[model samples]
Target: MTHPQIIARCHPALEALLPKPTAARAALPDWLRAMPSEAPAETLNGDPVRTLKHCPPFLDALSLGILIPLATDLHFDKGAVSWDWDPPALPDTLISRSPIALHLPEQATGAPYPLAVNSILKFLNFWTLEAPSGTSLLFTHPLNREELPFRTLSGVVDCDLFRDGYVHFPALWLDRDFTGTLPAGTPIAQVIPLPRSAPPELTVTTMTEAQITANRALQTDLATTPGTYRKRFRH
Candidate 1:
């Protein structure tokens, strides 16, 4: 089957500071790429599907989206936000400074807003996502990653029609006690491109007798032969 293509671009000035979109496979962390020391077992740990490197779909989604990075050093001190940078005025001199990432004065639009239902929201958009005609871009937090100090709010943009405008990201800074430099090149979002067609119909059913037998056989194979899924089932 043919694969769909997602195109990523940026302003000429940001071309160097920001990373061009790359195949998700290239972004896999070294730890995820390494195989587990123990051999396959009957449990989830032994299963290659949970073993990180052997999971294809998860890795494939990661390859989507233009990876945006911090343009400067950002620091949060207790409830106060502060940073140290050269020229000390890049936000004023630069292309676009996302107010969502900064601590603005009370009178400014950059001021933070707290929500009663969930976490607070800020106006932190930094990237513009686009897909081919008849497609859209889904922006979300990286899948299965809980180590980061912030969570990006999920969004869907009809990029094919909105290519000229930039969509900013509003993040909920999770680590209130966080302090120090959130260095540049740190991945801040994952963008997935999908077709804009309507959702397909869904069907649900119980397993048939033959399917039950097949599952039993597969279970026996999994117990007897390690990596059965890795060797045969995984695409």
Candidate 2:
């Protein structure tokens, strides 16, 4: 099926520095790219929840949205921060003038939040994300990316009407002691475009006897066959 497109726009100065966002499903790891293992090897200390929920396809699809990467290397030393633009950029350029602007806690958080820290700051990565006439852009942290030192707050923007405006990512600093180089091209946010139509009405009811029997039979088949879901069920 043909789907709508999500366009990424940037300043002329950043045309060469920052490439457009890429498809998240492309160039996935071998384990995810490969077919489901018929006789999968279990780890010595594997959690059942992880084993079940953290399947290759599941994790891959969660990350199968879109990714926006950083344009320059960022370094945080003690209280001083610096931005090192990769090549093309002059050394004398103002490092303090950050492309990723900072938003005050009050600006991000509507009401007076009662956090212990008095000076809470968030980094707002710049991106002009646009979608079709009736769609909005949904932003969130990349799935299974625990190594990153920050967490992007989830948000949705009505990009269809607000396409001209830039959508900035508000991220909380999770690791304070992280004083290394955050290399350029490191993905800072994952975005998904969703239609803004009215959602389907909720209908709750008891399962029919036939459905119950079918579900039980399917459960039994899954219990007996290792690749029942992957081979027989999944399209």
Candidate 3:
């Protein structure tokens, strides 16, 4: 079966220097890669209980999309952020010189988000993303990446319709005390392409006898059988 294509385009000068967007599965966190699927836990009577490695849905979520990496190395020290990348010279009218930008605090005034005093950092995208026709792209923080010092805000764009312009990501700098280098190729965002469609119709009703029986059976399987969802339901 043929799969839909998602294309990332960038200037020829940056083709070799910039880190290309990668499959999410290829970029799993180091800690997760080292974790065992099951480990003996003293709290569980020394039983070998399943860990997140055994969770299909969680793993699927982490591997579902393409991860966009940081274009250059960034350093944070004493509340300042700096980068040392010297991108190849291009036309003056071309992309911004810096790999980052910022949304002033005033822009987020009165917003409910907690870090209102801080400016929202933007990861400037030198590469433009293009998805298949009738598909929209979801730009979000990399799932389960709490180790990062910042959290990227989420947005949706009809890449099929607006593929020419750069879609910079705005993120909240969460760790004020964090002082270190965020290396180049660190995943800054996850992009998932989805079909553009109307919202599903909502329904509210009491469960029928068959539905109740099915729910009971599912609960029983969940409690009694290991990997039931992985073996029987996951595709």
Which of the numbered candidates is closest to the native, going by highest TM-score? 3
| Candidate 2 collision pairs | none
Residue 35 lDDT, candidate 1, scale 0-100: 51
Report the lDDT tens digits of candidate 3 across residue range 46-146: 99988999899999999987999999999998568998889877884368979999998889879776662268889998889999999999999999888
Tell me how candidate 2 scores on lDDT: 0.66
Please report how far candidate 3 places residue 105 from its true position, in Å.
Answer: 1.2
Lowest summed-lDDT stretch of 10 residues in model 3? 111-120
Ranking by TM-score: 3, 2, 1
Which is superior by TM-score, 1 or 2?
A: 2
Which of the numbered candidates is closest to the native, going by highest lDDT?
Answer: 3
Q: CA lDDT of 163 in candidate 3?
A: 85
Higher-lDDT candidate of 1 and 3: 3
lDDT, candidate 2, 48-147, per-residue tens = 3224333646765655678887667778764345885543443443333354666566664665343332334344454577898899888787766667
In model 2, what is the error at residue 131, expressed in angstroms? 0.7
Per-residue error for 116 in candidate 3, Å, reads 8.1
Whole-structure CA lDDT of model 1: 0.60
| Number of the candidate with higher lDDT, 2 or 3 | 3
Candidate 1, position 145, lDDT? 56
TM-score attained by model 2 = 0.75
lDDT of 2 at 26: 59
lDDT of 1 at 210: 100
Instruction: Mark the 10 consecutive residues where model 1 has the least summed lDDT.
Output: 85-94
